[model samples]
Target: MSRQRLEHYLEQMTLDEKIAQLLQLAAPFYDEVGDEGQITGPMESLGITVETVHNVGSVLGVSGAEKVISVQQSHMKNNKHGIPLLFMADIVHGYKTIFPIPLAMGCSWDIKLAERSAEIAAREAAVSGIHVTFAPMADLVRDPRWGRVMESTGEDPYLNSLFARAMVRGFQGSDLKNDKERVASCVKHFAAYGLAEGGRDYNTVDLSERQLREYYLPAYKAALDEGAELIMTSFNTIDGIPASGNRRLMRDLLRGEWGFEGVTISDWAAIKEMIPHGVAEDEREAALKAIIAGVDIDMMTSSYVHYLAQLVADGIVDEALIDEAVMRVLQLKEKLGLFEEPLRGADVVAEREIIYCEEHRKVAKELALKSCVLLKNNDVLPLNKNQKVAVIGPFALSGDILGNWSWNGSTELTKNLAESMKVISPSNIIIAEGCSIDKITEPQIHEAIKVALKADILVLALGESSEMSGEASSRSNIKLPEAQLQLVQFMKQLDKPMVVVLFNGRPLDLHGVYEEANAVLEAWFPGSEGGVAVAELLYGAANPSGRLSMSFPYAVGQIPVYYNHFNTGRPKPSEDTTEKYVTHYLDIPNAPLLPFGYGLSYTSFTYKDLVLSSNEINETDSLQIKVKITNEGKLSGVETVQLYIRDVSGEVVRPMKELKAFRKVELAPGQSREITFEITEEHLRYYHSDFSFTSDSGRFELFVGPNSRDTMNAAFRLKK
Candidate 1:
């Protein structure tokens, strides 16, 4: 349908019908609508009539071709204009063939693989009649205490921005109108929901516009730049106003400054929560403020449906605003080609054939293989196949490996550690559940010790369950359960080679397990074929290449530790410094247990002979930075070469180091390669005190290395 036709539909809709177009309800509301157009079931409490349900713009949390087809058929029969309903769901990482969570995908540092995972998710969802997926959550996360860190890529804005664009391209593709295998992408938590105060969910977020623009907003802009079809408002308050009702944030910044013409939506029930947030006095005010703030869809909220029409009638809200919001909804449906084919890609046969298929599972396994970060290895990894291995702990046989937001993933189809290890070395593996996640008895501990004594080595599988992270699951003490720690202490008494395999959602404190274990593998809730991938890495079928996107803190007190932190005036001198008066922790080091971009490969690589094409460059010119990398070990492996820069002096303080660029290369034993990176003025730009984004003329330092903490540095100058 053309713009003129969409406008025509807007003109044809009555006030009530137009108001309904701005409201979004769950699948249960539509499922209970009677044939005579009366509310009969779940929606009765909201006082919503069947007529309002018939005109609802979209449905949430519903899928499968049969259910979607039935609902669409019923809705069209009652809808006066016969406009099709849009189906949206939380297809975060994958729809059915579960892949690793977004944080694990970030650790892989493979943008193409991330895009491929999104493509597979789109294929499965489109076949099941899902038109939009609330995914590619681009919030820049620095605090691991926030449970939703599992949903974000990492701490660095540069890396997260790259991933945000890749996810958008994967979901929407080049032509969403014609591609039946794709679904429109909804980049979410619109502004910074990750910086919630104290890392609590839905807490207040207070930051200067300069701080917000510099660190948090870049990833979201990157998503919009990639043409993501929709943006969802965050639940937190930005500068004392809820994001759903902040006109300066939504209308002035997102729509005005960024020029994002895409649809704007609220996170589940965020529009109505403004009253509790003390911003709106009643539902009428909530509806008025949200629409004026450019929110087009109120998910799971009755405020818009009940109060919008009356507010417009009383001259409190403009009818033009309602027309604009309704027009955006109609334009989205037209972009989806809903007029020509009401059921865009709904086919029960296709849903069965495409979802959870072998091809999709292959990608899941491959990504899982790359997502496992080998955090520590004291020469105990790449175990020999003939060695007798004891896989002990709660995760040994548990199939709850698919992390949060995997609603469609089946635990029955997921492979556990014991199952996959047996397939790799069937005759030499033993298993025992020494303790549960939180509790342990003497008999269970005795049996676990007995099992450990029978094996040549122990693979201690442990960590938080799926409930520990994602959404409202934040924890002040981010450590393993006490029972698991006690289990580790008991296993350490056996004096055997121990490899701690973590199945978790966020970066952990790892105090007990890190010091006691011989090797530690951060296998973050790897999805679907997680077990198979870990087994392959254990036996040397695949090498460990995944790096940490988020830092692992030394202690819980250092809650928000990250690599690119700003240098304080009274900074700690060095590890050997005896200066107690400086800004240093008395008990622990000021650094993280493991830094960002930190990982290990079975094979080793060495960096040498860093060189620059020029020592000084103007704004228009670019500099070529080069470094030599060699595989110094006797195996083939992939290495992520990272480049960082620092502004020696600025109008405002600058970070100690910022990741500017990075590259991944595979090298065989004794191989040498020189990688070159081009740095332009764009990479150096930062928001000033006036909120202007530009680079200043100053001296700079550049560092290139395998990780953030340990690197060789060279000096350069930036000329205006």
Candidate 2:
């Protein structure tokens, strides 16, 4: 399965066989039994036949060792060259032991943990016969209205880039040649899929080329730099061209400028979608554009299978392009060692032994604990074990904590808050299902209140169900569900200390519930052992250290609010005072309900004594900034010290602040640590108005604090 052999195999392939390698179908196409197993969503209409299915190079959405074995055996029997069919699935978070969603995992701010999660996912997925995972979705999301925000890391380009590298390393590992536990990583939605217009799914994205490079494209670069094996074209159009067929994006930028040699695949029939996108006249034209644009695989589409051979025959498309695309596909199979053993890691014994095993669940539990963000607290957390506790809400005893993209995971394994808490103190805990997620009845409220009256403390577990957040689930109004809000209002009348444990996939506008609850914990779809993790935080077994990766808007009016927003000509007041003509919201404050990088712990850390090695820095030189942090509160905790920088003056306007660097440190009570950050010219450079990625000689402000909004600051000058 060497390069030489791959080339030889390509040379022996017929025009139709080469075209077959560029086409990918689903589990249904391989079903020889009957039409019952056939997925007629779009394939049947495409006129794909048994012959075309036999020649398909890869299969999508098929898992399990037995199923994959059956499919591969059937495919190889008919594949004249004996090229193995690549098995790909959307194993986003975890395979069996579901971990926190990507957004929540980003909140951990622990890159090592993020890497471990991907590694675990790779191991579990590989054993189940999945050769590729469309993961480490390196899209930078700012608008919460986008339902797919749950799939991305967060809003910051720098943070997303860091996570992108970590996940790639975790998925592919160091050596794909020898690694059995790793699966190939496909860094997806190649260009700005997160910046959909109106914050709607698959909407058009329009941005200046400068803005594209400055804010969106960095994460994809980071992933590719870390050796991601493949790139998936986004569903949206860049400018006016669909990403799957945009030659400027695929050939000029990705292949020409970036020098990416990996295979590029269209995202779930995106090539055929070019017709609906108004770029192509028909499937023939779509196939020509995609293959010419260097797309190696047509995922779940028959555009290549139906048109490519004829297009090549008619001289509309070159056969060399077909060979190039087919070669890349074969090269990936060689790299994955699928050419050597068709069933690479499909060991049924290993699949059974490793899936949701105790070791895997322990890591899942640890990640879930680290991902829970403490949004607000009023000396009511760390509930006393002896105190009578009432766990009242829809999620209190429900096992629906596993988030989206948990393909092979089981909710049956998920523990509820009440179930986990009962293990700590069976005699002191009372439980009641207040109401359904979006429903509240008088009888349900009365029953919840009856249980609340007997308890010294009330833990209200609330928020959206798992279905309300992932793909195609965008919301115009991000407020709490009406029935859940009603339940909260009813519980407010109980006069007991209440803590709100929220389970959501996106950042919510918590206007109504934030004021009524004594403490609020953003659990954010913690997976598998989520309930146990929440119980641990409630009883002081684990200190909550997760920070907000995406800003929680104060209201839905401030939809696209983020930390790194450019200043306007007419700026709003920095203070709480109102101004008539200044840029300010008429109804709500300009700030978010909770700012980015904001989180609370059982303990507290105070920062002081900011000192710089030099007040001035040259273009080639680096400056070191030192800050002292002390754990002031009683309990031990982990504190994420965040560093932000802002250009005082530029050719164009600059954001108020941009996160450059951060570190998470664990400290015991009364312990002091000095954190140092090295700032260089590279950190100061940005895409100028004229598209030059260079900085001007100017004064820069540096802020070091717990969150973006509250920080101690200093100023320095950069001498060119």
Candidate 3:
């Protein structure tokens, strides 16, 4: 399959055949077995025929080598050209051996581990007949009310960019065409879908060009730079028009400026929704706008399949656009080696052995270990295994730990908190379901109190159900459920040393549990091995090394609070300041309850001896900064050393501090290491008022520390 061959095939396709090649339908539409396999209702609703199903370009939401082979064989038999069908799915976190959600993985801050997780996910998915994965979202999330925040890495562009590249490399590998165990990466929700208004899913997004370039666009560019194969258009609007039909976003910027020559597909029926979005009058206009805006594939929409050919025949839309879109689709199929081997890597035997195997489970456990952040501790962690520990809450024995988008993962295969604890200390662990995720009864409370009274230590497993976060699951109040809080209050009266192990998707307010518990572990939806990982850390088998990627607000009023925010003219003077008119909350603190990069380990680390090579540097030169970190505590642990820089003055307003670099160091007791970071001119660059990315010659401030708030500071100067 060369370009000439693809062109020859394109020349042979009829108008209906070409239009069919640009439409993507789900798995049920193409099932030729019986009435059970066919979705007759949707088929009639979309007005598609059997001939159209035979000629469809791709299939989504279908797996298993047997089913995919059956559908492909049937489709090619009826399809006159015998072109292979591309299979895509939302393999977000993991395929079978589920790993932590993207937000939890970001807290690990280990690029190599992140890449390995994606590699395992691809290996499992490729064997099951999936060709493309809509994952590594690359959306910079600031507001937690957005249910899709679980899909994003975090709030910072630089950190998310690093992870975006790791995921792309992991999913596609070095050579996607030759790698049978890898799947094509589709970095999704192009251009700021995470900034949805009111932190609601599919809400409008409005930002300035400069603001978009500065903070929102970097991660997407990073993914494309890493050679991702496909890009999915977002559902939200950019500027005024929806992203799927916005020419400036898709054609001008993504294809023209960024030089992305890959296939572009609309997010689930987004092109058809443009009619209701008030941008298009009907499906005919929607189809016209989407294709002209450079959307190559219309997902789950009849707009392209039913109307594209008519638009071209009417002379309003050029046939070249259809040719180009079809050619890109064909080129992707060829690149995937489908022309040579139509059933590329789908093997039933391999799918069974490679998915949820022992080796993949080990990596999932390791990532889970690094992702559970120790939010609070008053010397009650690393509990003695000999002590009688009561495990009580909805998640104590429940297997809803594998968060959202884990469609292929089964709860029965997961080990819950109670099971893992019993494995470590069978005789010393007692379990009770004190309350459901959102409800509790009087008998349940009484049973919980009785169980707590018998144990020396209480390990309350509590948090939101898996449904509380991840796509279309937003909540206005991000606190623990009222019933669970009441359980905490009743248990607090027992006066036993209590530890709260939270399994959640987003950063929570933690009002009741934070103040009452002696220790709090933020085990955010820690996938298949979440139970084992948290249990190990509890009994000194492993250390808590995870940090917070997103900030935890003290109250819901502080919705958008983050460490990288800009300074205000009427900024709050100080924590102790009693100023009347400063930008301080009347009843709450301006700072978040837990800031980004904030976490606690079993051991302690100290930072000192900050040194700078020189106080000033020119544009072509680089500056070297060094700091010494020592493991002061008796136990061994990992520490994340963060580097931040502040531009004193710029043509436009700038953040108080921006994360420039970070490195994780492992050390034993009393071990000291000198960490060095080199800062070049590129690290100092920022988007100007006119959207030009460049650095200014001015005084700069540098800080190095474990987290955002607690840091050692220095000064420098940048000269042009």
1-720 per-residue lDDT for model 2 (tens digits):
567888889888888878878888877665452323332334565677766776778888888887787777766777778888999989889988899999999999989999999999999999989999998899999899888899998999999999999999999998875787899999988899999987899899999898899999999999999999999999999989999999999999999999999989999889999999998999889988998888999988788988988987898888888888888888888899988899999888888998888998999999999999999999999989999999999999888888767868788878888999998878999999999999888899889999999999999999888888988888888888998898888889989999999998999989789999999999988998899999999999999999999999998898799999988888886647667788888888888889999999999899999999999999889999999999999989999999999999988888899999998999999999999999998899999988889988989999999999889999899998
Model 1 agreement with the true structure over 570-620: per-residue lDDT tens digits: 989996799988888888999999999999999999999999999998899
| Position 318, candidate 1: lDDT | 91
lDDT of 3 by residue, 624-704 (tens): 999999999999999999999999998888998899999999999999999999998889999998778899999999999
List the global CA lDDT of all models.
0.92, 0.90, 0.92
User: Each prediction's TM-score against the native?
Assistant: 0.99, 0.98, 0.99
Q: Go through the candidates in order and give the clash count of each.
A: 0, 0, 0
> Clashing residue pairs, candidate 2?
none
Better of 1 and 2 by lDDT: 1
Off by over 4 Å in 3: 31-41
Clashing pairs in 3: none
Q: What lDDT, from 0 to 1, does candidate 1 have? A: 0.92
lDDT of 3: 0.92
